[model samples]
Target: MTKNILISGASVAGPALAYWLHRYGFTPTVVERAPGLRGGGFAVDFRGDVHLRVLREMGILDEVRRRQTNMGNQVVVDADGGQLAKLPASFMSGDVEIERDELSRLLHERTRDHTEYLFGDSIASMTEDADGVRVCFEHGEPRTFDLVLGADGLHSNVRALAFGPESRFIRFLGYYVAGFEMPNFLGLDHTGLMYNVPGLGVNVGSAGGKTDGGFVFPSEELDYDRRDLDAQKQLVARRCAGAGWEVPRLLEAMWAAPEMYFDSISQVRMPSFQRGRVALVGDAGYGATLGGLGTGTAMVGAYVLAGELAVAHGDHRVAFPRYEERMRGYAEGCQKLAEGAGPFLAPPTRFKIWQRNQMYKALSWRRLAGVFDKMTTKAARNITLPDYRPAPRSAVPRESA
Candidate 1:
């Protein structure tokens, strides 16, 4: 039986789910608000063992490996912009460091032919019955589907429609973050430079494709609305007002830059990842930040969801429950790590920041590796996948060929 699957958001998790769903003989339609593929941003990585295995099974490891950013080491500077210390890139962005948007585009390209991508559209309402789900779109005509998945983001439309309001699930991590592209005026090479004002702020710029520099300002609590980009920009501008070392210049460029991304640096914690036929796969369900295992969890969640659905014969009740059960532990662990990173990235106090920096310098690579190994091993062990055999050759339809 062919099942019609409606996937919201076309970034990482949506396209990934579509890829596996298509391979499992289900038809997937992805709806994205972005008119086209979004390009450029900080690098994201696939750490640990299981996530790498997912990439390998998906047959895109080679492609992703080839396009990795490989940004090398970073040089940290003090408040006066004097060199403090340097660390390897692997520590920051993990083993594979590809530009975040690049990975999204590559994953989208892989499912382009197999999935129906509806750009510049969003779901307005979803009403589900025993038969199927009735979906009303912001642009397209109303339709029905066997199931709907929300990979939209932290403020997921599907989650808002299906679950309660976002405030119920989203936990503020007491920080605000913004990232945008700028000119390579710093004339940096593949190396990255970071200037830390200790607890006040931290600005990082790296020479890479499509990304010139990024500014990260830690805040106690943010008041600006997330949907208002203009206000968000003003918030960032106000926070860094009269700052030193090319900050004013960067702000000027930021005012003109077409693409600006901002968020509250929070995590989405849910008692359950799914309710009824509505399921959330990625950031919508659990997101802490780039530092958290959210990316890895999303990749692994996509794999498990699709695999479970395939094994359960498209029964969301069985598949969705199993998917959540397999991923909840890993998601919680990632969220915890991301929470720690917020303080570690920019400690709350100057004394604490100095102590953390000293610790980072003192820690040996072997010790760091041991800590990472424990994290990865624990996360990887949370899942137990079924050996679902492939369908018989005779079951393959000629149209699918």
Candidate 2:
């Protein structure tokens, strides 16, 4: 029977899953809360051979490489903007770095013809029985599907509805980050500047004539309204008050920027990725807020989830566990990468900040640089992907309306 699958969130994981599921002869319908594809966010990279091979399978490797930021070295600067040290591109860019929105758009375009996309809507509730899951959307009619997947990211509405409250699965890593677009006020080109002070820091990078910037600060769990953009901006402004370097100017730009992204640096660790007919892929399943190779991991997990389902002939009882087993170790390893990022980016004390700066400078040495390269490569290459062929046309099952 052809299983009908509904995937939430039209970002990286959702569309990738749709592509694979369609190739495997399943029907996939994706619902996204956003009005349309999003644009302009931080850059994300694909590392090692594993990630490269998957992109090749999707036939977008060359396209992605063509869109590479080709960013140069990043300079760490002091309060007066004096260069403290330089970190090479290889240390940060990995194999290739593309803007988040660009990658998402490319994936959507690749899968659009084969997938049913419902934008400007969200999954509001779900009820599961022996054969399928009945889902209610906030802005559309309720429907039932053979399986439901949550590719909806860290604060996934699907996960919340299907599994439980986010508190049970989310772990705060003691920091908050905000990113926004600003004019190329500094006139930087294809490079980045970073400034740090005790418990706060800002990184601004120039690309394609525009600047992408962020503020990171150490904090305990904060009590704030998640839906209040104005309040979020005010909180960021207050936390960054009196910061030196270009921070004041950056704050000014932040205040006027059209959109902003703010969230606690956190990870989602679930005991199992699926329950009944509903499953999760990407950050919705195993995710770290930042520094975790989440974008790459999401692509990988989406590939595996669809492939496993196809291989198991659309039986969630068999496919979901296999998918989880294949991904668990790799996902955990990726999540661990985020553990040090909070302290490294926004150390709680001035002495720690100085210590981190000195360590980063040492990474310039060939031997020291090789250590990070090997570590990241190993993390990305941990799982050997299976060669999953498309099922025969006659093998596809019929779905019940």
Candidate 3:
């Protein structure tokens, strides 16, 4: 029997899981709260051989490479925009970097014909029994499926509904981040400029004719409406009110930006990724915000989850446990990478900012920097991916092919 699977969130993990599930003789349906595929967000990278292998299996490696950001060295700038130091591209871009929207579009294109997509809707409630899970959507009719997976990201609605409230699983790392689009007024070309002050930092970079601006600041847990865009903007403005460098202009552009992304820098550490017939994947399961190499891990998790299900013949009781066991260590290592990112990027005091700048200068020496690179490479390649043969080609529909 072909098990029916419902995946929430049409971002990286959802569509990737859909592609693999369909290939492995399962019926997969994806529901996204967005009206359509999202566009224009931060750039994400894939590092080491493990990440490349999954993209290769999906047959989108060459396409992703073609669209790679190709970002060059990043310039650390002072208050007067003077270059304090230059950081190598390898330290920032990794092996391959692509815009988040482009990655989403490619994954969606790959699986659109094979999977059913329900946009402009979200899961409101869920009930599970011995046979399957009954799910009700905020904008659509309730339905039941053999299994339900949450690939819905850090603040996953599915995780909240199925497991418990987000507070049970989230660990805040003491920072918040916001990013939005702005005109390439600085005329930056495949490069970026970063300015930092005590407890606050901003980076503005351009790629493919537009600039991406980001703000990161140290903060305790904040109280704000997650859905109110205007309120979020005001908070950002207030937090960044007296920042120097090009921040004033960036703030103006932020207010005018068509859309913005705002969230706390945190990691999700669940005791187990599966409960009953429902399971979580990607950031919804084990994710570290910002610098955590999450995109690659999410893709890897999707591949492993689907492969295990196929290996277990679509039995969640067997497959979910196996998946979690195999992924736990790797996910924890990836989550650990986020631990120092906030303090490193936005130091709490001016002396600490100076200390970090001096450290970046020391990294200019190849031997000193190679150590950090080796650490990242080790974390990225920690898991040995199991080779699961593709499902029989006969199971694939002609149109999907």
Model 2 over residues 1-401: C-alpha lDDT tens digits? 54799999998999999989998889999999989986645788889998998899989999999888888888899999899888888777889988888899999999999899999999888999887888889989999999999999999999999889999999999999999889998889999999998889789998656689899998879889987879999999999998999999999999998778889999999999999998999999998878889999999999899988997888888889989998999999988877988888888888887888888899877799889888987888888788777666345323211
TM-score of each: 0.91, 0.96, 0.96
Off by over 4 Å in 3: 390-401
Q: What is the C-alpha lDDT of each candidate?
A: 0.77, 0.88, 0.88
Question: Where is model 3 poorest over a 10-residue stretch in terms of lDDT?
Answer: 392-401
Q: Write the per-residue lDDT of candidate 3 for residues 218-288, one digit (tens) a residue.
A: 88899999878889899889889898999999999999997888999999989889999999999999989
lDDT score, candidate 1, position 94: 68
Candidate 3 colliding pairs:
none
Error of 2 at 224 (Å): 2.2
Tell me the spans in candidate 1 whose CA falls farther than 4 Å from its real position. Answer: 363-401
**How many residue pairs clash per model?**
0, 4, 0
What RMSD, rounded to one decimal, does every model reach? Answer: 4.1, 3.8, 3.8
> Model 2, poorest ten-residue lDDT window?
392-401
Give residue 94's error in model 3 in angstroms.
0.5
C-alpha lDDT of candidate 2 relative to the true structure: 0.88
